[model samples]
Target: MRTATSIDVVDHDRRRLLRGALAITVAGAAGLLPAYPGVAAGGDAIRPFRVNVPEEDLAELRRRVLATRWPDRETVNDQSQGIPLAKIKPLIAYWGTGYDWRKAEAKLNALPQFMTEIDGVDIHFIHVRSKHPDALPVIITHGWPGSVFENLKVIGPLTDPTAHGGHAEDAFDVIIPSMPGYGFSGKPTDTGWGPDRIARAWAELMKRLGYTRYVAQGGDWGSPVSSAMARLAPAGLLGIHINLPAIVPPEIAAVLAVGGPAPAGLSEKERATFDAFIAAAKMGNRTYAAMMGSRPQTIGYAITDSPAGLAAWMLGHPGFTHWTYDSSDPEKSPDEVLDDVTLYWLTNSAVSSARLYWEYDGGRSPAFAAGEKTAEISLPVAITVFPGESYRAPETWARRAYRNLMYFHEVDKGGHFAAWEQPELFSTELRAAFKPLRAAK
Candidate 1:
């Protein structure tokens, strides 16, 4: 779920050719769920939204799946070509016959969810409060191909910060919001509202909840959003902690970037780190990011409606991401990955979610840098890198912007979805990283 980096997940030219048709789908409307009033300034504090992703939407997906105009598969290797027909057909059968959206909806309803407008969009987030009187307000952000479901496991550790051997001062009032064009939030009709816009809106949201100051944390897309929150210096944003840092060395931009030459002007540590990141990304979790960046909506039909299609689309994930798939250390089961993807489908938010990538890739998102900024943050920033994530900037590069850097952690077990895969370790690092701020307060 940690997604600041969006590298090509496939061999470039082949991926490029696949976008011709799918690119068109990104522009058109796919999931037209009810839009809450964009201009509402004073609605009820908590507008109840259980996951009743309408039956009309479900029917639409089913119809499309049955009528799916099958694509011809490239021979042999599944790597070069797009999702294979051999895999997709059976998955469709399962989605229609076996996948259960109502059950998922019931589970979501069990959490405390509320919607409030910030910057003309209806922000849907789960605002979970602890029994503890004083809980630190912590907002969780998800990246593309992900939703609020990323941190569903960490809810326990985050809410009950004390029981997890952390201080009562560390207890968090958790807020997990659906990003723009992703889940319940409005698919931005215009371009300007990107991650920074989302971050600013989030800051406003915390203030609306009556907190003068609070902490921010996220991985993947959430990482940048949280970074933007710190960068914006919004009221009460105490400190920001993230899973990954999208690094761009301005001085030697050519040498270290993805397609750049071998890194030059580097210390041994920096060189080793850079090489490791490049190597991992090439070997692990590359395709999904490539497809999303190129033409997210190209295959929207599969993800949005066919439950089986959705599962097959991300079937390699939990194992590819969590250690369990290969058993290195930290891992999660297939059920967990299925649950996250299914949430999007059951709620019929798949295409809308993919649209975020289209808009972001289209240069519409704010948090994603134009080229990469001069690591301009002054507040304390902490980064936790996981195994499946493939890359973690070395301290030398990471320190360029985070001048007041407090912690740099690298764990071996988990992959991209840290909170889901290793909540205990993740929560531990979070409490420790923010300890200075919590102590000050």
Candidate 2:
């Protein structure tokens, strides 16, 4: 275990006593939360935002984590049962005692963060413009169990490519937005905030940002939102790049749905991918998706109330568990994992974020479904298959699924959270993936 780092603490006992008075005033009998300070009173105003988690909230989070009741270790030593108790215990201990949410908060505030209203929800985003001339504008989205924190590492490299072993031409004006119900973004008080709606809001967001031509990228939930934007084919959207592309043929998907063998005529890579998907399904790897899609509110109760429970639940994600969690590996550090889990805890967005699964037609949407048609997407599409991803998307299927396939390459590293796990490699892939689209710009 890595030695715990200390944080400089200022006594906020007085502020804690007056915390209720600092709460935003309710607008009316409907009890609407007040608009953030500096946000204009009217429509389409993009206001600067900063992360300032209350010190008391952090204190209470640590208290909850330390107060957690122990669950007996799983009968098996492996992770087949779930995140093993031994693995989570140390991580939770660090989260309670060693982790500093202020560091993560400071990292976020170091960047250019902003909030804007889109489709009745206040969306939080990080907007960074490259110094290079004619830098291509690209909107990137984060997935479940992740917040904008996932993309933090790649921002500097992508936005300023020259300094990161790439040409100025590779520079990108990056737009990373927190999904409607995730991070600092306002949670939806009603239904209808699915990927399609989120996609439209992203398009509007780019237009409002004055980017007449832009591209998009995503993995996990971001995949569907970006794909939806492709389907929308909004005028400014030049193309899209997805690390997690849904390219399985309907025939193959149907067979897998029933736990059948791989269909015939698949290439070795395709067959391997097919087998992997079948194996994952049998292993109950997607049980989390099923639970969140069906009854997010039910499980939300436990995760929302218990900080340790929340950390364990989020760490159960295949992306986090599969990563090398050694303290020496900065990219896959446990602190980084806790950063994401802590964000969910601080914002009380466990239920709101899970609801995105519910909104995806109980997880039957094309994003989660393997065999959905990709013909509706008239715009150019690019894909990068990371070796550690849940399922390797075969080139054959990718070409077939994306009619106007512009780029497809398999990289040696990274996984479902490719950008988070391998930011430099992920940034390089983006530079190459969107190179062709740059000509259009």
Candidate 3:
């Protein structure tokens, strides 16, 4: 997931009015009301959608790639400056000559993709119903620098556990939505489309889909959204399982913010984790967060226009590639990373996506900020802390953060992009985390 900036909050009432009008327009076009089906005479409709970028569009993307103005090499020998030119050159070469968007499109179209209006934005999602009659419904969200593509690898294993190693009862009917302003989803013209609002939209979305009972799962930005969903505790929200659990305690966050050392009484492991986070922060590795949160629109012009620029911007983030398996190996390929960048480029969502950063405080990481403001999630909460993640919250912090921590485990493999990096492991974690919730409403 990629995030940098947060747009300053605008008036909520005005944004609501605009969304209401959009809802009416969408509803009338589909011969339905903007409200959920059960609540009104005319109900909102979920329409099937296809990913079909015209040939000319693909050609233009290629043309833009070949026409890019090359930049001089950095003064440093390594990534100390940023993504080296050597790393980006081959990626652009493959993107221009070899990569096939059609393959990606076919993969998505093969699944059940749909579009629906939710709080004014047209939410695009893949809804795959499990063959198992008793399969649980789960809405999985993608993070920034990511799209529905991030969760694609796990779709089959999750929805058809029988085909994998699990029994029929472990199946999950998956719902992976492109966040508003990302990928095929409609962008918010006004402000106020942050994770909190997105959570409400998710709740309304599940209800509209006729799913009165469901659980939520996500990592990276997905974690914050899922956390919000759990906090909102919507009717019939079974529980939430997050790989990147945003469970940093507030005192630790305050200390880190001030460049102060870890509090005096922490254990060796807990203190070491906090110390590592502070060290990374001081290294200026997360400057992108400050930039995006403060001035996403300004940076948007460059990223939106330049394909290489967009790719590098994404790669510049630490632990993003580790989201891919064997990311550290020199023999590792850039296929998955290119796929993510291509989606952002084709969608022209550089600026729109960056605006997501503007919704919160500029300096702090979203995970820590999430801890500071979010109320303790009293419902069942499960967490999987992967070793490769930038911040692997100690169990102590997680328990303090989540009032009802049903499950917590430290997986040997995977990273920030856990689900995408290790689908098999990711799927197994979900099956175990939500097993108890299966019997609930």
Candidate 4:
């Protein structure tokens, strides 16, 4: 439930930073909470990392497909309306015939995975520590229609900087987590798990790892969650970097449109970057946002039932959601688009994943919309603006939320799935954004 539009800016709950990603417990629904017995991220606390895909789970997925009842295509033939059943049957046939769930399961397992109970639900994440002695700690959060799968391509570059032509100093102990209910994490069976709760979860996650300072990076839903972390000002959350911003405001738009003074502590180039971001948001973010906000589950079933349905649900997005290209002529290659969508389909998370929309709806929280004209984030912030992202968050409006924005960049190519599409560009901006703290640590 929203507190009210005009209430004084609220600070995040002042809770002690917990140790270990999932073990930390917080207030849950009705004041109930989950418990983790004495856990730290290292040594004994580090449980064996593996994702067990029970045979029954796979059997259930196949069983559901076999038992699917066909619906006539004329009943809903339109693409924009929902997934066309006519198109879905063939894909489901392929899923039952050719798709290999074990291989998909293995690909995910190759990366060390961990799950901890953060707040009330289980938080599933991938933690890859760089061999580099000075690796920076960074947390990557995925949004709706996305999961750690979206950022898989970028994990290697982030985890091993030298291999990607970057200094080992830029290496990161990267953390990729499936946001509540999107992947392996526990479903938000109840409400109250919004951006603010997620931010707190990230803060606790970082603290559990013994990271006194680190970078927070995200795109899509990740942007606001990271922003909420900045608002919370956890002791170790030194800086925040986002590929997306919640929304741009009129006050900041006026400044960006008119080309006014840059926000305090931002470079002139950063100021111009904000202006371009402001300009882009008005034209691009509307369609995707409107769709994701409403009737997400209606479309969820379509993606769940058919791989082609899922592909169509996702393929057009990077063109519109990322900064790489316009909807008509997307900058990203079709292979790249298919790859991202494939990760979701191969994981068979389409239906369970879509449940996130239903879960959020039950709570009645609109995490994407920025009802406030200006939201002030107290911690240091950095933002990466990609071409196709719904719309850019200008520095003018950004300043109202983040008091200490350390860096900002207008990336050359990439979109909503920045980590996967342009890992180098994504890592570079992250390195630059968190450089100040890196030096201190």
Q: Which stretches of candidate 4 lie over 4 Å from their true place?
A: 1-46, 54-96, 251-374, 393-401
Per residue, candidate 3 scores C-alpha lDDT tens digits across 1-441 of: 222232213223223322322232444446532233433333366766666666766788899888878899888876668777866787788888888877777777787777788886778888888889988999999887778888998899999998889989999989999998887777786778888899999999898877888999988788888988988889979999987776667777788888986789998878878887887877677887789999998888798788888988987888663333234642234666777787788777777778888875553576663543445577889999888888778888778777788999998988877887788999999999999999995
In order of lDDT, best first, we have 2, 3, 1, 4
Model 1, 418-440: lDDT tens digits are 78677878888887787777654
Which candidate number maximizes TM-score?
2
The model with the greatest lDDT is 2
* Backbone clashes, each candidate: 10, 0, 12, 20
For model 3, the local distance difference test gives: 0.78
Predicted structure 1: clash tally: 10
TM-score of each: 0.76, 0.90, 0.88, 0.68
lDDT of 1 at 343: 59
By the lDDT metric, which is better: model 2 or model 3?
2
